[model samples]
Target: MPESLMMAFSWLDWLALGWFFACWAWYYEYSRRRQRSKRCLAGVMHGYRYDWMRRLLGREARIADATIMTHLERNGAFFASSTLLILAALFGLMGTTERALLVLADLPFAASSPSRLGLELKLLLLIGLFIYAFFTFTWSMRQYNFCAILIGSAPAADEKDSTPGLRKMFAIQAANVIDLAANQFNYGLRAYYFGLALLAWFLHPLAFILATAGVVGVLFRREFHSKTLKALAAGRDLDITFRGILQHEETTSESLKSQNK
Candidate 1:
């Protein structure tokens, strides 16, 4: 880069910004690997998704499954729309950057402020983060649409042409599609979390670094050791019980049909 462009930030500021991005990337990679081999939230939820798809294959009525998929797609759509609004607001903020800097300067404990150019660069970085989030959210929505189609095409329980192995394969493939969609949604949400941490950059580079680390720590705890994870893990472990419940439901449905006939 040109020296003129580099003049906006000190060496320490550059180091802090580097550390912020490094932490985000490092934690993302770590979580991805850990989830594959451990009982993290992602892993647990994937097992549930597998079960959901398997159960879906045996059911004649799929209103509940379709409704569940609709909810998931809505979540992705909501975030995608929100990201656009946030991007618009950030762009508008660029117009008032000088006034914003003046307000920051008046604060008693505020550290040495960045140049207007540096402030604009930071805002641009935030805009970039949300842009990535928006893309992920939209992609996730598309994947959920694929999952819906998979559900619609699933073999019926009494299909003479469909073997047990074929149905099982279909369930696994459908579950995997849903899992990929969910992972994309997670990535988008993670971007939002890290973007919030980047806001501390306006105050001080050290604050930015600390905030970034804090976000990573919070994410680690929630994904690995939270009460929600424990609940899901317990549910995952009760596979036999869940299967029995499904069987009971199937028997009850048959009984009701017979009574109506």
Candidate 2:
């Protein structure tokens, strides 16, 4: 609302900013909806996670499972720590606004020099993005810790007291937990992609708009149409047969239990 801040951005800049946020929000919803009936990375990986939990229940030795979980937690920790460092650097940069403005002015592609307030606002936007990422990453870590607890409590394959129905339910619930944690991690990573695109805003609004669109396109390809997704989808088809075996076991166990009672 400051006069200088008002002068920093033209109508085109405002339009570009609006476009950036709209694209981000709209793509998020689109991906979420598309995954329900489509073959996306998130949907395919979730199927694999369910398969993993089912296999985990069948194994008595789970040290490898625990190690995998630890590695995932470490990844979340690394990202959260990195986000904090970047935020610190951005905050420090605020103290040298005059020098930053000079650097921008020297750039061949710089559209216009921003006022100190404008520069600060840009930094603030970056700060907000990273703050959201930090929250998501940290939350993901906590969820993974919860998953560890679930892993610890999971029923072994040979345990007579655990019925097949109970085991199946446990695997489904635990897989859901893992999927939730993964969703948080994905959200945090998406924030990083957007933050990188937002860097173009310092040069020109049009550049920022184009960069944001580019990031969204890349995300879309990787999520829904990449080689990785195709590979996973192929594997998921095999998983269907694997799940069928588990269902058969469940049904046989129930029949035996009913006969005994």
Candidate 3:
């Protein structure tokens, strides 16, 4: 490669790498916060009586409420915005705009002979972006469909006559819907971040690999060590505690009433 070409490629490569790392950090932090909030909320719902947890993390947990419509709105916005950004990036990568502007202004990069290596790199990035976009959109659509089912089926009538199994089923469905929505949002956001990294690759191929690694690192933290995961586990514990307490209270009340009578 010519010295100038090499320099251009090197600069782009570094930019892509930096972007990838930055995105990874962003996601890691977000997931950590989310996990913490989830745990605190779970504690509150299950009557864990953790005043400090509530004081420090209550708002976050509230944000994670499985039924919150805001979560849905956020997901929708992410999908929409990501779709637009990705489309723009794709068009830019295709040089369509550059070609159109050729009549108006002479741009040096636009006029240079296309490099086989550069063209191949661009193609690879395009394919990756397309795959990520498709998966993110499709998954989000499926989650939205699941949410619709949940909205339609959720309890509207008195449950006095409903069997335990029926109630359990409803709870399961609700949980499933929440899980699906969360996953879709996570995947979609990651795709958007990756698209940015792909754009960075217009500068260099190594940048793409760096960005990929950074993203992977963030994902690892979220999946394994994030506060959100801890909170989720804690929430389960709180649920059991609350159920036990409720059962005990009912039993004690029944006995006391029988004796009084």
True-vs-predicted CA distance for residue 23, candidate 1, Å:
0.8
- Name model 1 segments beyond 4 Å from true: 240-261
lDDT of each: 0.90, 0.91, 0.56
lDDT by residue for model 1 (145-166), tens = 9999998899987899999899
Separate clash counts for every candidate: 0, 0, 9
- Residue-level lDDT tens digits of model 2 in 30-102: 9888764439998888788888999999999999999999999999999999999999999999999999999
The global Cα lDDT (0 to 1) of model 2 is 0.91
| Cα-based lDDT at residue 144, candidate 2 | 98
What TM-score number comes out for model 3? Answer: 0.55
Name the candidate that leads on lDDT.
Answer: 2
Off by over 4 Å in 2: 1-5, 241-261
Judged by TM-score relative to the true structure, which candidate is superior, 2 or 3? 2
